[model samples]
Structures are given as structure tokens and as C-alpha cells.
Target: MPQFELANWLPQVAWLILTFGVMYLVVRAALPKVEAVKLSRAKVISDDLGHADTAKTNAQSVEAAFQAALVAARTTATKVTGDTKTTAAADAAARLKEIDAALAAKADAAQATLAKSQAKSLKSLEAVATDVTGDMVERLTGRRPAADAAASAVAQASA
Candidate 1:
């Protein structure tokens, strides 16, 4: 009932106006600071994002450089390995050739010794055979053969 009276309407209207004005002024005063804080936060976030992008780019570049270095190292290692293998093969070939030469020389010396021994044994066998033949002939015929004749006959028979 008091709210519906005409006498209370003006005071209510005046209070309403006062309250709305204070609220408007307070909101207006705080709006710029809020906007400034929002903008500062946005700028900070944008700057952080830019720094992250720069870091990402730097990481990519560093990774690429590392890959390049790795490739170069692998290439150098392959070349060195190939060179070492070639050197080892060459050294082995040279050593093998020297060993083969020595073996051949040893084989030739053995062959010469074998030939000399064979010649000496043949001469000894020839002398023994001649003596045996002369003794056999003397025993069978009761006459001894001459040494030169027996030697000549043995030589002719062998030839």
C-alpha cells in the first residue's frame, strides 16, 4: 500500500536515479583499466607465442645442422673405412707375393738338392751293380771280367 501511494513515488524515483548514476560512474571508471589489463594480457600472450615460434624455428635449424653434420661424419667414416680396407688389401697382397716368392725359392732349392742326391745315388748303384755283375760272371764262368769292360757293358745296357 505504501508503494502504491503517490506521495512515495517521487522519492522512489529520485533514489532510483541516484543509484543508477552511481553505478554508471563506477562502471565507467573501471572500464578503461579493465580494457587496459585485457590488452596487456593479450600482448603478453602474443609475445610469448612469438618467442615460442622463434624457438621452434631455431630448433628446426639446429636439427638440420645436426643432421648435416651426421651425414658428413658418416660419409667421412665410410671413406676412411674404404681407404683402410684398400690399404689392408694392398698390404696383404704384397705380403702374399713375398711369401709366394720365398716358397718358390725354397721349392727350387729342395728340387736342386733332390737332383743332387738322386745323381749321387745313381752313381753308387751303378758301381754296386757293376761289382755284383762281375762277381756273378766270375763265379759262373770261372773267369773274372775286366773292370772297364764290365762298366762299359753296364752303361750300354742302361742306355
Candidate 2:
């Protein structure tokens, strides 16, 4: 009942106005500090974004340089490997040619030696065959065959 009484209304209105006025002045006084903090924060964020972009660009350039170097190194290595293989192949062919020539010379020498030995053995075998035929004829007829005839007979049989 007292809250709603007409006679107390003016005092309550006065106190309410006084309280709200003080709160309004305090909020008004802090508005510049809040605006300053917001501006500083925005500047810091903008600076960070610019730095990040610069770093990204630098990283991309460095990565491109590294890739170029890698490609150049691979090309150099491939060329060197090809040159080495060619040299090795040439050396191998030269060595094989030398070995083949040496083997051919040795085979020719061995064939000459074999031919000489075969000719000497054939001469000795002919002499032995002539003697055997003469002895066999003398044993069967009690008369020795002539040396020239025995040799001629052996030669004819062999021919």
C-alpha cells in the first residue's frame, strides 16, 4: 500500500533518476577506453595477418628454389651415370677383344705342334709295317723277302 501511495511517488521518481544518471555518466566515461582497446586489437590482428602472408610467400619461393636445385642435381647424376656406363662398356669390349686374339694365337700354335707329331708318327709306323711283312713272308716260305719288295708291298697296301 505504501509503494502505491500517491504521496510517495515524487521521492521515488527522484531517487530513480539520480541512480540512473550516475550509471549513465560512468558508462559514458569508459566508452573511449573500450574504443581504444578495440582499435589496438584490430591493428594487432592486421599486422599478424600481413606477417603470415609475407612468410607464406617467402616459403613458396624457397620451396621453388629447392625444387630447381633438386632437378639440376638429378640431371647431373643421370648424365654422369650414362657416361660411366659408356666408358665401362668400352673398356669391357677392349678387354674381350684382347682375350680373343690371345686365344686365337694359342690355338694356332697348338695345331702346328699336333701336325708335326702326326707326321713323325706316320713315318715310324711305315718302317715298322715293312719289317713285319718281310718277317711274316720268310716264316711261311723259308725264304726271306727282298727289302725293297717288302717296302714296295707295304706302300702299295697302305695306298
What local lDDT score does residue 149 receive in model 2, on the 0 to 100 scale?
A: 97
Clashing pairs in 1: none
| Sliding window of 10 residues with minimal summed lDDT for model 2 | 117-126
Off by over 4 Å in 2: 1-35, 135-159
lDDT of 1 at 84: 100
lDDT of 2 at 103: 90
Root-mean-square deviation per candidate: 3.5, 4.4
lDDT (Cα, tens digit) per residue for candidate 2, span 49-139? 9999999999999999999999999999999999999999999999999999999899989888888988787778788888888899999
In model 1, the runs with Cα more than 4 Å from the true position are 1-25, 139-143, 152-159
Per-residue lDDT of 1-159 in model 1, one digit per residue for the tens?
Answer: 898899999988999999999999999999999999999999999999999999999999999999999999999999999999999999999999999999999999999999999999989988998998799999999889999998888888887
Best by TM-score: 1
lDDT of each: 0.96, 0.93
